[model samples]
Target: MNRLVPLAVVLGLTTASCSGGHGAGSFLPSGAPGAGSAAPASAGARTTRSTAVAAPPAGWATTATQAVSLKSATDLGALDATKPVTVRLGLQLHNVDQLKSAVQSRAVLSPGQIQSAYAPTASEVAQVTNYLQSQGLTSIAAEPNGLMVSATGSAAQIAKAFDTTLHAFTVNGVSAYANTAPAYVPTALNGIVVAVLGLNNVQAFATSPHRGGQAVNHASPADSAPAPQPESPCALSSVFIVGLPSPQPIPTPEAYTTGCPRNYTPSDYWRAYDVGSTSGAGRTPIAIMAEGNVSSSIADFRVNEQGDGLPEVPVVVKQVGVASPDTAGADEWTLDMTASTGMARRVSTIYLYATTSMTDSDIALMYNRWVTDDLAPIGNSSFGGCEAFPYLDGSMLVDDEIMLMGAAQGQTMFASTGDTGSFCSVGNPNGVPGGAPLVEYPAASPYVVAVGGTTLWSQYDGTYAGESAWNAGGGGLSQFEYSPFWQSGIQPVGTTATGQSFRGTPDIAMDGDLQTGMIVYIASAGGWTTIGGTSLSSPLAAGVWARMLQNHPGLGFAAPQLYHTFAMSNPGTKLLGPPPTINVGPFHDVVSGSNGAFAATPGYDYTTGLGSLDVAALNAVIGQ
Candidate 1:
């Protein structure tokens, strides 16, 4: 799941390549796009039919035909003067085969090569390093594939290190190119090493069954199925949802961004939330945190239909981030913090003020406002800070405060599991003595239900068609102190030491793979891009919980009670026991996928935890 797709998946495009103009209208919101819903299928067909399967070339995923402009780097003085940042430049190797045969017979680093044991050697590493040395850049890390190089002298001096060119043609039969001789260099100390994943297999789709509610067969295929189990009834819990703005079309020249699916046609998301046939919706004042200008996205969703023939949840927008006039870095993330409509609704905007610029106090201030002023029972956070544990600590503090505030007013706080699995190297403070693996922060926090990821494949006929752990799913045992409370029904099946290990993530899951993912249209970015990640799942669940609370107005804050009611209780109890329905239960145990070393098994796997929700069952249990 930590693997990053190489540029190859981007249609052979690279930072250097560019495609001839395609009609902007060709792009539509994600999900089964018009007649061309199978565009990905066609593109994949082209790959298998055309390219030779003899191991893909190094930088195999590099897709673009042109170099990404370093002008932004130049204007921002990306490169530092004096003490140049030592960065492990992520690049696609132009000639991996030649380099591999020249070096290791296998070319790629043997499995035992890297620390986490996954990275392969990039052909560009050796060649680029050699070229850099010729220009006076020195090596720091002496890894096999690429060296961690330090730029000597000024930004301009470092910029001169990048001097080369590359070329390629587009999938649409157009030519494109990239300039190696970058005019500017990056100045930030953080140098991102971008790894291109599988080039030709990128996919995005929508999986809502017939609008007729025919109980669409939701079974995992043979190749990707969970161990066989008895059938259970539908867990019709309360459904909640938030709406986002409709996406504006991305113009040409920069139309590639349109590859992303935009918002669902008016009804997609809300309908999905209504799985449980419960009514009355509860007293939980579901809150949405947003930064700025999402009025259009929300309005579009409101007009959309829920499956049962209703508009998306009714929402009231309010400002909560930095003052509207302020545009500082903190102000940006503040917007996400303040924007509170989506988690319970499944749609909302990521406030710009939510970035690292805002202080914990600033975040706390925003939280207080949403609980007190905005009248939300639970605040859904779909974002997180850098891999630093301190950030998690601050978030935990805010969460605790929000919970307390919500308790006084009867609300709960929810946050998304961070998306930084590669940075697992970051240690956690509350972890075991032997230095446990540090899971994502805020999610790892005791107060939060650390969400995880999964890959969903539609069951065609009677068998599974395609399924794989979502390449981007995150999961793992907590390096931080195990919050035993979060570990209720989760028990080890394999090795007691392993299964019963630290508290893992993803209390629940929903559709999140970019392919089969929900659609989101962003007018700000002005394009349609398919979006996925637990960021999407957590909010969807939050919206459901909000609705459940709304329907059961007397069900005081459910955070602490959810664990007691459903977690580790007797099998007879709705939590561990058999769900009321004997046909299909609310939860679909994820017996597949893995986050890192952890695999999805019988009961709980890092990939999907307690499977997905039994909304109906959830409502029944909570309402009891």
Candidate 2:
């Protein structure tokens, strides 16, 4: 059973033409905001600008206007003119070239260093703030990094200020508001203010959480008996298998039978992934990008830790915007906390960056906090939206900038690739099975480690048995984002419509099949429940990453090193001649199964990416 819930927001921005190139060398196109020419002195050092540019007058002139489209939604009418709205103005970066170069070199800079060298200048911030104030908008504040400026006003005020119209609409029977026309900026803040977010309130991201059914005993076919009751912490010996006939649909759980698979616990993951004798040990701190009140989740974590006989990890909640009392995402947040901490066993701290809502604007703030705070070296985002929406609205570019800064600061975030196989879902809440081929954003962004799903089979003792790509796992070529430098030579199943190679997901895989779901404690649910999805896979990856960071504290971004390690282990020369007798690598390369359009292969494939990790082996060679 799939439970679709609001998790994050999606905001829109004006799209710009990008230059065609390979690797990090091709910078943002000239038309793109924040495109700079200066190069930093060193990866860790600050760059020196030749001269500052003067700000333009606060006159109302046409800047780039964001094209808006209400795909498949019914237009109701104009939104309430007096309705209050909050919008975020994305500012241009100071040294875009330098920031890209620093990230490419794997420079480990601090938050302060990143701000000093690459953040928007005071003049740029002032330009945007001045423009907003001139338009009669209030509560104008700029982020410390100067990447975004927030303002509040009524729908009329916002529409007038950005030269657009706000109209009400019903999307999948849900009320929503969007700009009827393109949203533009004043002439003064043309390139300086890249994107205007929050002009429309659209449900952008959907949480991927699939609940498991009662344990079935498939051992006896002739013996007709009642299904087994749900176990609090499922036994390790009750292994589940996929590909069997199910009473429900593809994503839903199959009918209960005898001796079927059960949910997995923290200890089960530790043993299955070969994470022996390694805890974060208070060295690595991680963050969870979440929404609403997670107080119950914290309580649930403590309950899980005590029940599992594990050490308690400190959790600090940081309210990004206003404190939201909404607990709609209780299962998702709780699963993130429990699954992540459960995998690492222990960590220095668990920071929850809870936002007011799951809107694109609010979620952007949550991500910005995680990057600018620089407290957590690793973070987990178990939510995402279709890549096309963000790309069209410009949040993709906005979030990508934040992630670039994160990469330069040696921070790694893991995001779920979604749960609807190779295509995006159009259904409300839990994604339906069909739509055009598109990957999930944040995950599609080259900066994050896009985690996919797998159906894991373990031994009776919970030791590693084998894995295959989960049928419903989200993985495919990106519609907008280009492939990063590390993925240069990799040949996935297909190419972009233009016959070019774009970014493909996921970067890695983990257990996400409902039949092999993790045993989680949801306070609101009143007890333990088995849940799966890319949501489960992402936090699990983050926890494993925390353990790796604990062992090697100096490791920077993980993708480059991960690809390099895989390439070293499997040489083309050897693969071309014959299949290697022995497989040698930090990852357990999954060579079976498919996620709709793509299938897993010998090396890197679209379905499973670089496959699942061998924690011990990965930790040993990640830093080297």
Candidate 3:
């Protein structure tokens, strides 16, 4: 596809989906409460239990989400009647099915080949523009492929053009306006305009925030110990980092029985994962999707990169609307930047798309820009929408269309599965016992590769031990989406009590346990904070893809190939049940603990998905 953005960047559930769900599973937030440990309520709406049990009053889209009990952040935001609102017009492309077929075949595609095979025809773009004009919309700018058209209109004008209502809602101290009702397009643009965006801004998302910057205990707090700290400044080695708090009065070896040290850096991860030599090396420009500025953090990143003997990488920060630094924004950006660069050592550029807010509308626009930007081939999204949130509930179709567009252009988006384990629909800080499960979207989206987490057990000398499913990694079946054909071969296994044959999450996992977390510079946490969560996993995996692409240039989207290759090269190891001490070529079969509901079994399970990465082995399979 034609690279559009140049080197410059730009850049929930809960709402039951409109898609069909087999009765095999109930998409409720039951079972156990999530970790239930309080997170710094993500910047926009704080996710709360579903209060709107009653259906929409009248004349609402049948698929409209449960009415949320908003706390009105009137001080922070307001809906202005005359202010022109920019709504992205999603046009349905004509040969998308063909594109899917091609993707399934894993056929190598060149930029020109991908564009010619999947881009919307000029006629389709023109039709959408003309139809929007007829509805009195203004400031129409059609994106390159013509599948996206941005138009401006007043609230009244937008209401008249699309059947929807605008209203403001608030949660936690953040607020934004949204289309309270599900919106629709005119018959003139019915098939042409697949979906309209920027309608609702209710649902919000975040990087599954690192609460209090503490590591979660695997067995009990006594099983492992915190990392040793340096009391005297000179005691710290030249390469050794020193931001850790004084070690516990009697530092104990914490984390897995592997006795891995707590203090780690980008280089440590490089050596441990055996990806030290696999570098993006000034070729691939990775795209990190989040919000806020990280000028200082970028400087720190450069220092760390050079410290590791990797070339300095230029970071390009681009804004979607009007994004600013929020509470944990600095830390989020820092970790994402450094870790991704650490893996893809020679990556030329890192494009950070700072969206104005976590509002659903802005997020939709965020993905649209990422895909349509066309500069970055690989993307990393650390945040996720609550399944039942109205914003996400409404934009599912529009979002899917955007993902497919990216896929057609050889773009692959890696999203964080979530931090809340089996109880994805609900917040699980306490790591409670039972709660109905829900999967986070964008990750749950079939087109993207959902990255989960693992409790890495690599030691100081790079000695590898077995990894287990993170107590907090998100997984289970997608309530709305059906299983993708590529992964359909694996039998769906959810919590031990139940199983659903739907789209299961976390195509793969990587180190994310706070105990074994990657070391990152978190300004808000007073310098270096050991951070974990799928937030780390997503970018880590994105970097891996950048590496894979650097070597295997024409590799198709990762989801299909992961399964196809795994099935072909599965060592058929019978670690538990019987004899074969077989070796899984591409995967490191993780069979240990459970996420909450599901146990990490011999084969594919909800937690740890297809296990952690074996870079050398992975390259062998995917590079084919």
Over 70-118, each residue of candidate 3 has an lDDT whose tens digit, in order, gives: 3223423335667567777655544555666766776645656755656
List residue ranges in candidate 1 displaced over 4 A: 1-276, 280-284, 292-321, 324-359, 371-374, 391-409, 420-436, 458-469, 484-502, 525-528, 556-561, 565-585
Off by over 4 Å in 2: 1-65, 214-262, 427-436, 493-500, 571-584
Once fitted onto the true fold, the runs of candidate 3 whose alpha carbons sit more than 4 angstroms away are 1-80, 110-117, 170-174, 211-245, 249-261, 276-280, 306-309, 322-328, 390-393, 425-436, 494-500, 572-583
Alpha carbon lDDT at 502, candidate 2: 72
Question: Which digits, one per residue and each the tens of the lDDT, describe model 2 over residues 231-329?
Answer: 311333233222223333223224221122345677668877898766557678889988888888788888777756578888999999889898767
Global lDDT of each model?
0.35, 0.69, 0.59
- Give the alpha carbon lDDT tens digit for every residue of 288-391 in model 1: 44333444545334322222233244455555433443222121121222122332333222221221112332344455455444355556655443222222
> How would you order the candidates by TM-score, starting with the best?
2, 3, 1
The TM-scores of all predictions, comma-separated, are 0.46, 0.82, 0.78
Question: Root-mean-square deviation of each candidate, in angstroms?
Answer: 20.9, 7.8, 9.8
lDDT of 1 at 556: 43
By descending lDDT, how would the candidates be arranged? 2, 3, 1
- What is the TM-score (0 to 1) of candidate 3? 0.78
lDDT of 3 at 39: 12
